[model samples]
Target: MANNSLLEIKRSLEPHVGAKVLLRANGGRRKTIERTGVLEETYPSVFIVKLDQEQHAFKRVSYSYADILTESVEVTVCNDEGQVRIEYLQQ
Candidate 1:
């Protein structure tokens, strides 16, 4: 059942590949980081975001959908048509 749910989330995100996204995550020690990137890919267990690099080399970050489900991360996807979708994994 758990695997099925993850699959569903993956499917929902597939269409948003290449869409702009804002990722907000809580680092340790009460610190948080927000990144803007393109939704690069969605794998079975995780999703990748290609970060917009200004001064450094290209970088990609991967986070499991479970992070959203656990509220450890928040993802906001903005489509080309000006539609925005926010996803958070819930129990």
Candidate 2:
């Protein structure tokens, strides 16, 4: 049942592939890592973010949809107008 719910969230994000997004993830011990990237790809259980490397080396990060659902990770997609579209995956 939980898998089905996750699939729904994944589907909702499919159209945002290639869109610019800000990713915030908890790194444990009160640390948080934030990055700006393009929504590179989405899979059955996870989505990848291709990070901007202007200030550092290029990197790609993946986070499960479940993480969003649980608020463990936060993603904010930016539209062409420069407005932020936030997705709050309900529990």
Q: List model 2 lDDT by residue over 1-91, tens digit each.
A: 8887787878878989999998888989999988899999999899999999894376888999888888788888889777565455456
Q: What TM-score does each of the candidates earn?
A: 0.81, 0.85
lDDT of candidate 1 over 40-88, digit per residue (tens): 9888799999999973265999999777766788888877677565564
Q: In candidate 2, where is summed lDDT lowest over 10 consecutive residues?
A: 82-91
**Which 10 consecutive residues of model 1 have the lowest summed lDDT?**
82-91
- Displacement of residue 82 (Cα, Å) in model 1 is 3.5
Best-fitting candidate, scored by TM-score: 2
Give the total clashing residue pairs for model 2.
0
Q: lDDT of model 1 at residue 85?
A: 57
Report lDDT per candidate.
0.80, 0.84
RMSD of each: 2.3, 1.9
Clashes (N, CA, C under 3 Å) per candidate: 2, 0
